[model samples]
Target: MLPVDTTQLLKGVLDLAVLAVLRDEDGYGYDILRRLRTSGLTEVGDASVYGTLRRLFNAGLLSTYVVPSVEGPHRKYYALNAAGRGELQRSGKIWQDFASTMDDLLRERETA
Candidate 1:
């Protein structure tokens, strides 16, 4: 299949993506980056993930804490707060509805 230009698409959904990941568990910067990649967001960048984390924290959607590491400096872990959870729910529903519409459109095109 042709490669999709996910940059624009991702820009709109990065907040939802990052929040969704943290919903399950808290993670440090690099850990969150890895999770995003492992979960098939291969084009996601580290800077984008870090920036999203900071933005979400500042927006009161995320809570953060620092944990000391033996191998390096302390790591800051991020977790979802009540506001974040609510945002996630809202965004997820919007995404699902939009995706369903897109699927319907694509199927129509295919059948035309």
Candidate 2:
């Protein structure tokens, strides 16, 4: 059996993962990337996360604001808007259903 390419898998679900991370708190690009890595998605890359954030913002699913930082440059934090929250809910349900189906199939194979 071939090993799964998790980076490819992460590409498919990066939007969902980013939205999930922003569900609780708004964060800047690097902070969001860090949260994802800390949550065990260490394979997620900085560029991927930044691109995802930009896409989400452009799609009207996210809002951004700049916060001044004394230590460095201003940070643009991304937050989930109403549409983003709705999308998170809708996509989250779809993901749950798909995951359940996959789990069931794998379990059946194990039993067989």
Candidate 3:
């Protein structure tokens, strides 16, 4: 099989990852990007993540509010609304199932 470009893979899952972050707590644009990087998703870009935040908010999956920050300007923070939380729960289950199936598909064949 050809090697998968991780950037391509990230595109499909970026929404879910963002939802995952917001599932735990609200965060601003840069904070979300930093969290993704800390979790070893180094390929994720700042603009892409910020764009996704706006898109998700537009789609009504996420809700936003402004809060004062110590370092920078009063930042827009994002959190999962009811719909967003629902999406996260559903996506989390889907990913868990997909991972299990892919693990089976990639395993070595047994020598009987």
Candidate 4:
């Protein structure tokens, strides 16, 4: 078997990544897009991020606020709420466990 494309694999965890980003600070759509790009997730699209934001907001994991910036239009910023923080903590632990399992499997295959 060939090595997995981690870029493709990352799609499964994009929600978690977004949650983690929001954990840093309240930010607008474009700011979140830029931050995710800067973090080496070059495949992420702005629309995808926006859609995720909407979904998360609908699910009550995120709360949005309008912020006025002189340079541009009023921005709708997203902040993680208590529910979101708790969800992130749970998901983070689960991801760690899954990653550890994958690492072990890959290492075993490499040795074999």
TM-score of each prediction: 0.95, 0.98, 0.90, 0.91
Show where candidate 2 strays beyond 4 Å: none
Candidate 3 residue-wise lDDT, 49-76, digit = tens: 9999999999999988999879978988
Instruction: Show the colliding residue pairs in model 3.
Output: none
lDDT of 4 by residue, 47-105 (tens): 88998889889999999999887997899999999999998999999999999999999
**Model 4 ranges with Cα > 4 A deviation:** 1-7
lDDT of 2 by residue, 1-112 (tens): 9999999999999999999999999999999999999999999999889999999999999999999999999999999999999999999999999999999999999999
Candidate 1 has what TM-score?
0.95
Cα lDDT of model 1 by residue, 1-108, tens digit: 978789878888999999999998999999999998899888998899999999999999999999998998999999999999999999999999999999999999
User: What does the lDDT come to for candidate 2?
Assistant: 0.97
Best candidate, lDDT-wise?
2
Best-to-worst lDDT order: 2, 1, 3, 4
State each model's CA lDDT, in order: 0.94, 0.97, 0.91, 0.91
Look at candidate 4 and tell me the lDDT of residue 70: 100
Error of 2 at 56 (Å): 0.3
Angstrom error at residue 33, model 2: 0.4
RMSD, model 3, all Cα superposed?
1.9
